[model samples]
Target: MVDLQVQYQQLKGEIDRALAAVLDTSHYILGPQGQAFEAEAAAYLGVKHAVAVASGTDALHLALRAAGLGPGDEVITSPFTFIATAEAIAYVGATPVFVDIDPQTFNIDPELARKAITARTRAILPVHLFGQPADLAPLQAMCDEHGLLLIEDCAQSFGATYAGRQTGSWGALGCFSFFPSKNLGCYGDGGMVVTGDDRLAEQLRMLRNHGSKVRYHHDIIGYNSRLDEMQAAILNVKLRHIDRFNQLRRQNAHYYSERLADAGVVPPREDGKGVHVYHQYTLLTDRREAVQQALTTAGCASAIYYPIPLHRQNVFAAAFGGVSLPVSESVAARCLSLPIFPELNQEQMDRVVAAVRGA
Candidate 1:
């Protein structure tokens, strides 16, 4: 759904120079480029530390491990999200408790998350789905009252804000993905873990490496999940333009919302508590298949973010089978993501709107 070639061409000079510098240095792993990118990302997010990793999934796994979560621990999260949200918790040997989402915002419902808590509930992992931040004030208050950790899955919310503060600055740990399609994407796979705590930051850095603070002196078991220097360099160039890109995305989303006001489709909601970056301008329609087919026939691309909720996945069905989550299930079956990228123009957007109206 993204035109990476066009984006690259727009930032050609800076990206080419950055890659050339990395090549000249020949330092591929956790080198100066990665370190500089981490500092820039930390400053942008207003967090004390940002630990770069190989993938977003790795970032979530290391964050959970640093928080001392393991077997017997439970993490409450929404079912209407990318599988990696739950996979990270499962990777850390923690049980993922599925909660329903708010139908309007399509985010984890705070009340449902609170009700799902138990003695074993150690953390509340919330995803900022489709670039809209979850209602974090209540979730943060609940975490404080229960002595639970709060983790934000910010894979699609790179430039979003809530309550006048950046999204990744909330919670104990905020995980981000730099997949090429994200708002602040790099050339390839990359991710980061942001935190305000120094101790947790240290643990995350060591864990991303082979648990060796000092060379060859392993302190604990860890994983090899370091961000590549080249990708970091590319991200550094892209980061400089992320705000402008997100603003364009917001404009495209507004056009879509205005056009589809009474077209029997539900556009994404902006709750006034946060600014949406429009990672995906998703629409909800009962006739999802027909709408998508129309878009395809009209040369417009569309996709479903998640057709199956986490609770119904075959891998987790044995444990969460027969669970009834009306909102998440219904939303998953009807949600359709439209072509939303900074490169899209008015002509493209009009075509998509006309196709939807025709459908």
Candidate 2:
């Protein structure tokens, strides 16, 4: 649903030079490229620290580990997100409490999350789905009241903001993914964890490596989840153009919303609390299958972000089979994401809109 090749062609000169520099130095892992990217990303996100990791999943995993989450802990999160969100909590021997989402924003409903809280609840992990920032104000207050951690799953919201602050900077720790299709992705798998706390930052740095502050002395068991230098170099080049890229995506999304206003579909909604980066310009329609078929016939790409909620997935069915989250289930049945990217031209967007309208 993205045009990575076109974007590469547009930035070929800068990306090629960045890669060449890394190759010249032959520093493939935990080198200058990664260090520099972390610093640049931190500054851009307005966070005190950024720790690079192998994948977005690792970022979440390491963040949870650094936060001292373990067995018997419960992490409340939206069920309408990617499997990785819940998987990260499971990796740390914690239970992921499935919660419903807001109909418009498609983020975890703050009230529903608060209702799910229990004595075992250790954190609230909210996903900023489709580059739209969640309602962090209430969630943050709830965390503070409950003495819980607020970790953001910002895999789809690299440049999105909430209430004039960046998404990753809102919570205690923010996790981002650099998957190729993401808003600010790298050449391959890469991720980052950002935090304002000095202690959490240090713990994250150790957790991503072999849990070593020094060269050979390992403090705690850690994973080999370092972001490679090659990927970091690519991200560094892309980072320089992130604001422009996000702006273009936002413009395209607005265009789609305006064009699809009367197409019997629900266009993505921006709550005005923050800027939406439109990683995926998703719409909700009762005729999802027909619309998808029409797009395929017209040679246009469309996808379902999540066809089934995490609570309904096979892995968690036994544990949450009786639990009912009507909103998440209803949205999953109708959500259809159209092609969205900074490089998408007018013709492409027009073609997509025409297909949906014709359907």
In order, what lDDT does every prediction score?
0.94, 0.94
What's the distance in Å from true for residue 325, model 2? 0.3
Q: How far is candidate 2 from the true structure (C-alpha RMSD, Å)?
A: 0.7
**Which segments of candidate 2 are over 4 A away from where they belong?**
none
Estimate the TM-score of every prediction: 0.99, 0.99
| lDDT of model 2, residue 104 | 92
- lDDT score, candidate 2: 0.94
Candidate 2 lDDT at 309 equals: 96
Per-residue CA lDDT of model 2 for 1-359, tens digit only, reads 88899999999999999999999999899999999999999999999999999999999999999999999999999999999999999998999999899999999999999999999999999999999999999999999999999999999999898988999998999999999999889988999999999999999888888999898999989889999999999999999999999999999999899999999999999998999999889899999999999999999999999999999999998899999999999999999999888888899889999999999
Encode model 1's per-residue lDDT on 1-359: one tens digit a residue: 88999998989999999999999999999899999999999999999999999999898899999999999999999899999999999998999999999989999999999999999999999999999999999999999999999999999899899998899898999999999999998878999999999999999999999998998999989999999999999999999999999999999999999999999999888988989899999989999989999999999999998899999999999999989999999999999999899999899999999999999
